[model samples]
Target: MKKLTRLEKYHMNKVSQRSNGKVVAITPEAMEIEQRAIEREKRGHYRVAARLWLQCMDVASGEVERARIAIRRQQCITWSNHTRQGEYSGIGCRGVVYD
Candidate 1:
């Protein structure tokens, strides 16, 4: 079993405290999946990362957190599709050039 990272431990504690210890325990498998999803995101495999993130969301105990993850996953998919089609153009908010 993979040891939990500091961030993961913190997240687990926060969720537990919020739910008064009623939520499911954070399993090593879920952490492993999250790690893999992060790796995929870093490698620009956004579709794969989004899918893995959805899996993580499914295993997450909090409805609000799951919704947040779903939104993030959708954003990843949108960005990935746009980037692949050369539609990003390095533009930031208010038409500012980021690069």
Candidate 2:
């Protein structure tokens, strides 16, 4: 079997946690991170975007950013819980939540 490339590995890492029969919300913070990334790319600030993106993951700080990240992480957990419970109620829950 061919080994996964770096890009594929990155994609897989992001999705792996969600593949275990659970939902994951993208959250406003994550969306903001993504938006910033896009803006950075547009302004040719790819390195800055990359740094910000990494900071958005699992660990981040700054009172404001920390709060935002915590809220988003909670949203992701809530989403997964809702999805699991929905399975019992027969409601089809699909996709990430970001608002």
Candidate 3:
């Protein structure tokens, strides 16, 4: 089992509190997939990470909190596709055009 980060633990605690004390434990397999997704993101494999995040969202059913995850996954996909197509130039990157 991977150790949860303080942020992760804090999020879990918030979820539990929001759910009126119902513990929302993620399955080990889901945890493994999420870890892999994080690794992919760290490696600059944004598309793969986005797909893995979608898989994680699927596994995390029955909650409105999953909406946040879905939005983030969509953002990853959008950014990854834009970057792959050479259409994205934001804040600090090279070739950014400020208006």
Candidate 4:
């Protein structure tokens, strides 16, 4: 699993702080959109999920929703990098020997 970066942790902490000590229900429209995006992603529709996620960011009205987007976005970036690197090259050792 990819480890969370310091920035990611900071962002998460900020979001948690903004929750105001209560749970809020998202609007049906927003929930529908987010759910659709997740379903599309499960069906291998990456671009659709990506676009929906961006839309969610635009429509999100509260800190909780905004934080969800930020966290998911960061996770996507981390996963993308990890997958891409593994596909292109295997991890190798780096060291110097005295000549």
Candidate 5:
């Protein structure tokens, strides 16, 4: 059998506990990540926000928290893709590099 990484082990444990109505308490780091992701999105750093939000999802306390993070991540992903497309089409903003 393949060895399970820490994250994979956590996911497996959560999946098993989920059936027993357990909820994992989120850490302070999870909250920090959520805040950072929000700030990044506000600053139009969609790609960065998307990645942070994905990390946040991994530490989310429950299904609702995960769902909220999922929505934010999806929105950032769409915005990131749109901006990239715009740059590719030579319609980038004046004096603003996408990076």
Candidate 6:
């Protein structure tokens, strides 16, 4: 099993706390899409992860869920190294501009 990141653990804790540790129904399709997005994020493919996060958000069940996914998408976008041509790359978002 992949070890959970700090952010993932934080989300799990808050979600469990919110519902007394009970899980609501999750659509398998949405879960699958979420897994793919997470994998992309772990591989440093923030652009792809952002797209998958948007898809996951579309299938999310409630406002809170959608909001969480939107947060993830935004994080990806921030780290995506936005370019003048309106594209993203794996370049780390540390103020390095690639031409």
Q: RMSD to native for every prediction?
A: 10.7, 18.2, 10.9, 13.4, 10.8, 12.0
Give the TM-scores of the predictions, in the order they appear. Answer: 0.53, 0.33, 0.51, 0.49, 0.56, 0.56
Show how many residue pairs clash in every candidate, following the order shown: 0, 0, 0, 0, 0, 0
Cα lDDT tens digits, model 4, 1-99, are 567799976654465533543222254566667777777667756665667767776777666666776565555545445443333233453554333
Model 2, C-alpha of 55: deviation from truth (Å): 1.8
Stretches of candidate 3 exceeding 4 Å from the true structure: 1-28, 85-99
Q: Encode model 6's per-residue lDDT on 1-99: one tens digit a residue.
A: 467799976665466323432222255667788888878988888999999988887887656666567777888999887533554555776566767
Q: Mind sharing the TM-score for model 1? A: 0.53
Instruction: Point out where model 6 deviates above 4 Å.
Output: 1-26, 82-99
All models: lDDT? 0.68, 0.49, 0.66, 0.59, 0.71, 0.71
- Give the Å error, residue 66, model 3: 2.1
Give the better candidate number (4 or 6) by lDDT. Answer: 6
Candidate 6 lDDT (Cα, 0 to 1):
0.71
Better of 2 and 6 by TM-score: 6
- Rank all candidate structures by their lDDT, best first, as comma-separated numbers: 5, 6, 1, 3, 4, 2
TM-score preference between candidates 3 and 5, better one: 5
Q: Which of the numbered candidates is closest to the native, going by highest lDDT?
A: 5
Q: In candidate 4, residue 54 scores what lDDT?
A: 71
- Which ten-residue region of model 1 has the weakest summed lDDT? 16-25
